[model samples]
Target: MFTLPHHIEFLSDRWVEEGRKFLVGEAPKIRERPAPAERLRGRPLSVSGRFTQAPPHMNLPRDVGCFSVHFDGEAFAVTTSFDPAADLVIEGDYQAALTGAQMVGIAAPGAFRTLRREIDHLYGPEALKVRGAIADPMALEVLSGLFDHLGRKTVENPDLAHRAARQGLSGKIREMEAQGYTIVENAITPEFADEARETILRTLSMHGHQTMNWMLYHGRALERLALNPSLMTLIDASLGRGAVIASLSCIRRGAGPGFIPIHTDYSHVPEPYPAFAMTGVGVWAFEDWTEASGPTVLVPGSHRARRHPRSSDDPGAGVPIVMPKGSVVFFTEGVWHWQGDRTEAGERVTLHSHFNRGILRSLEARRIDEQMIYRNPPRLGEMLGEDDWFEKTTAAGRDYMRFNYMRQLLAFNEAGKQAILAEPQAAAPTKSARRAVPA
Candidate 1:
């Protein structure tokens, strides 16, 4: 079946090798078809790509990433060097190029136009630079089709499976399904939590406010944490694919009484909420959460009630979610929850990442920041609502490119979730067993 490897780092040597394999493997079947064979007529075609500002994590050997694929009518060759005389040359920001590659397949027939529109809208026109020209117009279409097929076979979130397995998230997912909430302890390293806490406090100090929204834009730390792979997997499982960010907010609470009352997150809805969840929230704790430290309290199995908690409804004393620092608690499906009283002297800092299903409107307005999109991967754009079809309209029509792209992405995510769920649950290690392992 020539299945792809479970993981392939983008722009790595392995990625280039797999790309060559895909092209070489698919070319024969493509040539067997009469239309492409007649159009090619044993003539040669080539494509050269140059990507700049490669993210440091890629650790690319070259300052500027370059690759060329040459088809000598009957066979294909892939190389790390560029070909100036190639029929087409694609040069752009590496991240934008990745976003294009992930989406090209869904924008077929108008792939070129769609790609240009998306790049212009998200990364500015200069983000993607095209050069050279195809002698035969049909050759351009053929090349587009070939790239589309190649893209579908490549360009995916490589960390989902590894992160899920490493974190033992299947058990957490099962717990969430039954209890309407689950906590991932030590999800982020204590070092990261300390850094994030400092950033939030500094931001709060500068702004002279106790709370803030759009925290993702304030610093690199918040931005990175918002797209945390394990947290994102939980969000996808609870809210389905194509979930957009409703808000990323921060709060610093001092010793005081709990101000927020018990309620469900479902904002304007009739009685008996839908079986599916429309929104979800992941709250990150920068410090150890204890009963006296004022952690969130959740009514176990209250989501099954499928309605808002009435004032007269005594849900009894709820369970306080107590976990160590660098942990996050995610609750969805209209879970009834509220803040706990803070009796301790120190302040508690938290960041809340709230997301809504793709079909629903977000609480925060969509803000497309090119620098933000360029700095991160496509995952950032997806959360910012850049990859979805909603609210994208002009006199011409709705943006079907984004619409189809999201559809394809959602299907892929669902498949990934199913695979995660199907895996056997591993038993938790005892304290002594954990201590025996090297740090």
Candidate 2:
């Protein structure tokens, strides 16, 4: 049976009724620039005269939050505005800078659509000004480098593939004990990680081959998305402004190796602002994914936290996202969930490649390579734009959101994703710090 968490129940009005209806038979289109597939990535043509420029070291205005780093998008060099009251900041890495420029190139149209949609919903109006693509592309260029690292380092490493697998498992255990969940960022070196790509794919493929809905996996999709400059820039745009994870992982089957309970990432992390400004998980695989194989089924907006704990009620207390190989699952992790898609056939296996801001603690047991992020498909250029919207993607700032969420949640490993999901929030402050909880 399918169940949904409450936080984003409002979306039911659209996501379930309209959105699901749209996706039931027809899948989202794959185009150079297709509209949102209830998500991001890709565009068609560049807008004319939309790109703009800004002086070095200057901030545009708070109203232009839509433009990520366009603090000063210029021709010679793009500038990233860190502080709302400051000028744009300058950086180097032209090859990568070109990538950011590419993102800016698309921002005029890309950001417009995204902001329009977002504003329409939350803001209840188009408060975001859809300005032409101005603002230097430099800042975002540097930002796009995040995905670049993911591709380069992992793919380049000779021993990385195998190591990542074994290490991932090991790291998961370690992080679970220390932090309740591990939040790994760059647990492995770039060159070293490259070797693990194939092995990772093999694991998912072998385990997924027996399933349904997700039998189509190629293993190279996420690698491409990692490299796409526009996409990378969008991911990077959040580098300084907000939280960006180079890599992320969460562990369950915790509390001595049973099943995980139901829960959400955002709920454990929650919203309202960054006590740990959690983020969505963008997973990539070395292969294709299918529903039968083991895709993570998400109860969208569970990040809003309306689901009650069902661990006391059922082992599969919540829904397990059925993520297709190479597909990214962007949802608040602190919500409700329990692993599903248990086909009684093979051992469950998967790898998580994620990103997050630096300040908060993560559930990953290992680090992620950012260099490789740009090399793979799901090209980066189409992922992020360069104009004011592009400028807005430059994320940079300290974030503590989602810190120790995994660690704390996993403490109840004996429970399940649902059991953990059902656990009440700490109405009263705990006596020990999260780190003190001891796995």
Candidate 3:
């Protein structure tokens, strides 16, 4: 298990000195514009960069030194500071800045791998680059934290875990409607949970390493678990009769002090928290969610806020949703949540399934086909995204791609008049706006 504090100490005592010897000389040159000026001419786009020196002619407070690249309706303006706040901000290591600036709106043809290798060579010997160790859990945790700090804040939703105790699996759907989320205890049988756990472990062992696509390839238990009658019923009630599966993945947390930043799952879904459902997430806990084990922490009643909350807004607002092994937790994509600190020994795993109304596309659209469809039970056709509803586009030509789901699609298109109103227009930028640089 990797702990952030210990990793920070390690960096201070070891990595930093080694990095200084090479990184200082190898870092990319900070000029007025690293790329050509023509690339930004007349393009309606903007992005920001962080942790480096500010560009010339751009004024910012001494403390906040981020820079921006803007394309005002006509000309491109690259400067430091947010005069007209950028549409996106690129943050992370030097490579992120180079890649982001190079490919602003259009794709650029170049060998990104070669570029990275050349830069790493300048940073010093290969050991100082820390590439090989990134696969280690501790190293990955440390790298995640460093990038998060260098980049924009993940979520602005306040932590409201304090009010979680008020909910005890009563008035399940009603509670979700009022508060934007709810928890259901004993949602699955102990035997089912055990089977799912074994399936998950076996799949992991077969792969020999962790990758994002495991849920799509293996884990029959997970696919069956998604079709659980009770779980589907809950989703149907909230997202209407034809809620479809957006993604089905497993979350495993080994004994460590690993922490995921607070954020919402609204990336695919359109913003301006709607009155109805767009995307919903279900987390089936396979182990007891306790303080020592570091279960998920969420803000109670935050879904109604219709906006993402910041960690700084009220950090204490969050409470951990502790439950037994057979329990499942359901929340709208808008609800703010994050992984809590795990100080205990052993590994914790949860089956994560996200559902969206039929009008939206599935996150794992390509992975699910006729062969995989035949394996699941008949009742799961709609939720597993095996029906015609997933095939046809709405009258307004909007589905998961344009709008989030049915509710947002219907709300935005009233007959022919488009009601494209931005909710809480000032509630910070979307997650994409925060980290524009793709890793």
Measured by lDDT, the strongest candidate is 1
Rank by lDDT (best first): 1, 3, 2
| Candidate 1 lDDT, 1-439, residue by residue in tens | 1112322445667666756765555444365555453566577888898887664445666646788878788767788787777888988877567656654344345545644664554456788888987777776656666555445444334334433543457667766776788777777777678989999999999999999998888887787688665688788888876789999999899999988789989999777999878899999999999889998888878889999998898857587878788889999999999999999999999999999998888888778888676545566776777667788898899987777766765765666666766766546633522321111
lDDT of each: 0.73, 0.29, 0.49
* Residue 379, model 3: Cα distance from true site in angstroms: 2.9
Which residue segments of model 3 deviate by more than 4 Å?
1-170, 214-217, 268-271, 390-439
Winner by TM-score between candidate 3 and candidate 1: 1
- In candidate 1, position 118 carries an lDDT of 40
For candidate 1, the TM-score is: 0.64
For model 1, give the 10-residue run with minimal summed lDDT: 430-439
lDDT of 3 by residue, 133-236 (tens): 12333322322332322221111001111111111122454456555666666656576688788888777777675424437557555655675544654565
Q: Per-candidate TM vs. native?
A: 0.64, 0.31, 0.49
User: Which prediction has more favorable TM-score, 1 or 2?
Assistant: 1
Candidate 3 local lDDT, residue 426:
29
Task: Indicate the residue-level lDDT of 259 in model 2.
Answer: 54
Clash count (model 2, backbone only): 164
